[model samples]
Target: MMPRPLLLGFLAIVVLAVLWISNPAVAFAAGLVIALWQKQVDLPHISTVSRYALQGGIVLLGFGIQASQLWTLTTQFAWIVTLYIGVVIILGLLGARLLRMAATEGQLITGGTAICGGTAVVTLAPIIGAKPAQTGAVLGIIFLLNAFALLSFPTIGQALDLNQTQFGLWAALAIHDTASVVATAQIYGDEAA
Candidate 1:
């Protein structure tokens, strides 16, 4: 048998590879199961180091995203961005209520709009008293929507006759995470990248 660390390392790679397969965000929850089975992750006492890493990753991610480009958004597309944000806020609120979530859950969803994905959720957790489990659930839902958007949005942009710049703007403004927006923009064309 492989050494314990080697075996665990291999499993980690395989897990991440599976995650990259782009399945409708189901993989994330599935990953949680795998972690629990392997005893690799401890839900209680989730480390401060891990939390810091998450924050660091988001800040680093901003290096790739030029916030200034958001200004290039056309006057014509204002309504589109507004509608997208509105839908996210409304559905997120409704979903939280449907789940019998507290105010923190709603705050997490709102933070997702104002900032990058998991980063936003983590940051808002302390402020709103959101439990770690709820944060995980919200992150899972966002991951699902992001996966769906990444797979479908580019095609929709083409169907709508959006130029590279237009599509980039839409992706950046409409998508919940900077990573997803960047991925969508890059997939559409490097012109916007």
Candidate 2:
């Protein structure tokens, strides 16, 4: 059974999240803070639940986007997306080699960087025979990066005087995770989101 204090702490976080927090990045940071405070509150299946929640949030965000707009944007920018992914992967691999990192770990990191962050890492982990420790490390790295992007992108976009379309495109291309990109865009405005 879960300890009473731990359970109360979790419940308080949930209540605060539901009642007050709206920003995804802030909510994530709050969770990180709570985890640090209660370092031993390990709940079984929490990872799986969090993963599904993230995926579901992304899906719900997609529903907000117009299908025609998505199709047009995808078709128009397909080449750019392909080229960016290729360059990032190649550069990541070379950087890993220069650092003399293991090939599998390097590939895992590159794949995560080039693709969808944790999702890419998790999907490739089993296929590439990555040890759990390696996967966890990569996920941690990606998660931190995503958090940074979420916090910084909007401020940078505004300081640079980027219009809604410009900021939206920049966020979509620059942020590693779809959810982060959307959240950053949302921070800018509804139009950007």
Best model number under lDDT: 2
Please report the TM-score between candidate 2 and the true structure. 0.84
Total backbone collisions for each predicted model: 0, 0
Off by over 4 Å in 1: 1-101
Off by over 4 Å in 2: 1-21, 42-44
Error of 1 at 136 (Å): 0.6
Query: Of the candidates shown, which would achieve the greatest TM-score relative to the real structure?
Result: 2
State each model's C-alpha RMSD to the native: 6.3, 2.7
TM-score per candidate: 0.56, 0.84
Task: List the pairs of residues colliding in candidate 2.
Answer: none
In Å, residue 29's CA in model 1 sits off its true spot by 15
What lDDT score goes with residue 61 in model 1? Answer: 51
